[model samples]
Target: MASIFSKIIDGEIPGQLLWTDAVCGVLLDIEPLTPGHALVVPRAEIDHWLDLPGETLAHLMDVAARVGRAQQEVFAAARVGMIIQGFEVPHAHLHVFPANSASDFELSRRSSRTPEQLAQDADALRAALRTQSDGAHVPGEA
Candidate 1:
């Protein structure tokens, strides 16, 4: 069975996508610790982060860094937090969110947002990401 993230990547389910490449995709988290939170996920369904191939893991982190940079700028965050807590979903993913302090990194702090709210957050991050990169990874980019 495909993981929920796989379903989102495959278009079987909707995802507020921000970036995509051959190896991975970035999407806004519905249950976010803060606005502009994103998940950098590999296209392959590897359940454990440590199990991913070196280059593949590197690519995911590289993408997460990009999202973190954008989050810092757009959200005016003092720091960007990242974590690999795979319990929520079986597919391995990194949670990247704007953090003003260490406490912002807590996974138990996640809060749900309506689809409209998530879309608004995605739009803000997507616009910020477009300004920093080639803009190719941003959704609806031409």
Candidate 2:
């Protein structure tokens, strides 16, 4: 059976996508610790983050980093937090969100947002991403 992320990648499910590459895709999280929270997931449905090959893992992190930068631009938080507790889906993914303190990293701290809200956030992050990728001065990149 395909994981939910795979279904999203295959277009079987709707996703507010920000970035897509050969190895991975980034999308907004419906349940977010904060606004601009997103996930960077590999195309391959690997269950465990540690089980991913080194190179693949590195690429995932790189994508997550880029998303973090964009989230910082969109949310303007003190920092962007990353979490890899992959229990929600079988596919390996990294949760990246804007954070002002340690409590912002807690999964229990997440709350649901309406689809409209998530979509708006996704759009904001997408715009920030495009600006950074297009040679703009992205926040959090000193």
Candidate 3:
């Protein structure tokens, strides 16, 4: 069976995707520590970040940076925090979240968003990414 991340990438389930490339995909965390919390996940379901091929890891971070920048702008965060905790899901994923303080980095604070809020947040990030990306389409930009 595919990891849930893979299922999201494959459209088997809905996800608020922020970016996508041949190597990886960035999506919003359904349960977010803060608004604009995003996940940078490899298309391949590697179970551990350390086990990823070096180039793949690099690509993931590069995309994560772009997503984080959009999150920072859209959420007006003081900083964007990055974390890797593979326990919740088998697939290796990097969590990139908008942060106003150290307390915003706590995974224990994750909360679910309503569908309306998710769509609104997605639009905000898409607009920011459109400007940042020089008009390139961010994943699921609509």
Model 2 worst lDDT window (10 residues): 133-142
Per lDDT, the best of the predicted structures is 1
lDDT for position 64 in model 1:
94
Model 2, runs deviating above 4 Å: 134-142
- Looking at model 2, the pairs that clash are none
Ranking of models by lDDT: 1, 3, 2
Residue pairs clashing in model 1 are: none
Candidate 1 lDDT, 23-85, residue by residue in tens:
998988988998889999999999999999999999998899999999999899999999898
Listed in order, each prediction's TM-score against the native is 0.95, 0.91, 0.94
Between the candidate structures 2 and 3, which one is better when assessed by lDDT?
3
Q: List model 2 lDDT by residue over 1-142, tens digit each.
A: 9988877766689988888778888877888999888888999888999999999999989888889988888888999998889888889999999999999987888899999998888778877787778624222232
Which one wins by lDDT: 1 or 2?
1
lDDT by residue (tens digit), candidate 3, 14-74: 9887777789887888899998888999998899999999999999988888888888888
Sorted on TM-score, best first, the list reads: 1, 3, 2
* Position 37, candidate 1: lDDT: 91
